[model samples]
Target: MANSSQKKIAHENTKILLALRKGFIWVNAFYIFYRIIYQWNTFELKLALGYLVSAGISILLYTQINTMGKPRYNSKGELADAGEDLTQEGLVQYAFDIIYVTWFVHVTSAFWPKMWWFYLSIPLYAGWKVWQLVVKPMLSRSGAGAASDAASESTEGTKSRRREKMENRAEKGPQVRYR
Candidate 1:
């Protein structure tokens, strides 16, 4: 009976977390569309730079907020708990918020509508998401694998070197390389 009740609690929590994540994601997606449509221009490069700055700030703040709740969210998230799943969704919201705010700043103050390639925003945002969330993690894992391989190779080299020294000592001679 106790186990059943605990499971129910966990399940309910997971559902809530999932819902929060979905809601945050929806907000992010909406903002992406809003920014692109509202600020269509040819000078997308400049716009992208501005967006990047805002994104940087937003990401920093977002990380700080999430980390502040690390004890609760990180562990729960790993266990597939509800509040934990919101972490990613929150990150997405943070990123889109950056872009939206930057767009707002540009349009209201420094924006020139004729300069941006607003059409590119859709693809750019999609690519950024893939690169940041998926591709980068994959690449980082690959890098770690490479590092492990290098470490293994160096360890083998050390073992072989020690064996060579022992063999040379056993043979009554200086090391000789025979072709």
Candidate 2:
């Protein structure tokens, strides 16, 4: 009963987490698009770029931390040696930290702000995360990303070998007779 309840909690938490992630991505994308369209010629590249750079650095740090020092896969799709853990407990609790700081800065910039630039960092950061999570994974699956081509070839070779072995066994017929 306890195990069952634990599973239920985990399931609910996973659903909530997924919903939040999707909402964040969509909201950021739409917000960025609206701002870009609304600003058009009035866009402030300096502020946008600055915000983006700061957010990008935070994202990079967060990514490195979240990996928990796991070895990156090699060109053959094999895990490399274990590396040192860069962040303890994925510390810094990245998302809230970034949101709080950026939000504060954005609100304060109001006196001299290009409204679009203030919020631009979010979409840029979200877009990068999306690219990493979605686009890059798709590319790798399609054998387009780094190491994917070699990995796919190896996978194909493995499948063919498996098929041939199965076929060879089939030719020998069943060793046991069924009643």
Candidate 3:
């Protein structure tokens, strides 16, 4: 019963994530079209190329998140484990959201310099994401072995009551009883 409840929760969460993903894609598409149709005269070659590249990236990420969020099934038709957590993909989508907003502000700031500050957030957020998703994992992987060994050593000195009881039972051996 608990398992079914958990599955229900997971299913709901997936639906929400998928809805957000679709919304992001639609907004991005709208922005791209808006720029092309409304601001075509202001476009530089470099900015146009960048938009194309960004569009391609958005398509790739959308497919990747879809693949990751899909649940697998066994041959017996039972639901197997869902693929990678959607929350992580949602974070990636959020990063793209920031980038899109920054890009819009950047383009608009050509007419009004005061909005220039908003674009600064792009590098700051990107750097933070890099630190979190890439640098932290690499650092942890390099130190994980030693860290785990030290953790095990520390934990060994403090057994839980359950562990102590199990050890005591093992040391006592089985007792024979008369009927």
Candidate 4:
């Protein structure tokens, strides 16, 4: 059926994306280690500071994403099913991915200084994520709280029939009959 074929395609896409993500992570780790271990004496202060800033941003964003309770990767290191959802968490992860790729480019640019422009994107993307994830939510909550207070005032005197029935049932407790 069409449903099964769709699922197969989705699984294949997941596998490909997961492999690419893992590959990038490993490559970045290896490059960073190589630079730090072998080229420490040649490293510029700017490059070291860039690495520290990137690492700090990465850790903070990762913790924020993790606390949202969505499992992005499974125990086998594959993408979790919910990872494909087009929800807020997914959007945040996508933004993180952008910063990640930019950070990689910034790292590589240590030798080719011409690519230094990529480093600018790291802070820009992070600022966008902060606006989307933090500031916007706080603004929305304040507006929603005022609206909810007004709505509660308007509905203060009435209980839905279903609520009334539920209350009555609670008052009666449990009933048992034997035949």
Per-candidate Cα lDDT values, in order, are 0.54, 0.54, 0.66, 0.64
- Candidates ranked by TM-score: 3, 4, 2, 1
Question: What lDDT score is found at residue 128 in candidate 1?
Answer: 100
Q: Write the per-residue lDDT of candidate 2 for residues 69-114, one digit (tens) a residue.
A: 4444569964443344322233444454564455445444433455
Give candidate 3's whole-model lDDT. 0.66
lDDT of 4 by residue, 19-127 (tens): 5457557756865777766677877887777667766666665555444434355689754443333233566657557556756765676556456567676569779
Candidate 1 lDDT, tens digit per residue, 61-129? Answer: 555544433223244453332233333456555554554554444444333443344535556877998
| Model 1 worst lDDT run, 10 consecutive residues | 78-87
Enumerate residue pairs that collide in model 3.
none
Q: State how far residue 169 of model 4 sits from its true place (Å).
A: 47
Model 4 TM-score? 0.42
Candidates in order: C-alpha RMSD to true structure? 14.9, 18.1, 9.4, 10.9
Q: Cα miss at 152, model 2 (Å)?
A: 74
User: How well does candidate 1 score on lDDT at residue 28?
Assistant: 44
| Model 1 TM-score (2 dp) | 0.28
Stretch of 10 with least lDDT, candidate 4? 79-88
Q: How close is candidate 2 to the true structure, as a TM-score?
A: 0.35
TM-score, each model?
Answer: 0.28, 0.35, 0.48, 0.42
Index of the highest-TM-score prediction = 3
Error of 3 at 77 (Å): 5.2
Give the lowest summed-lDDT range of ten residues in model 3: 106-115
Alpha-carbon runs more than 4 Å astray in model 2 = 54-94, 100-179
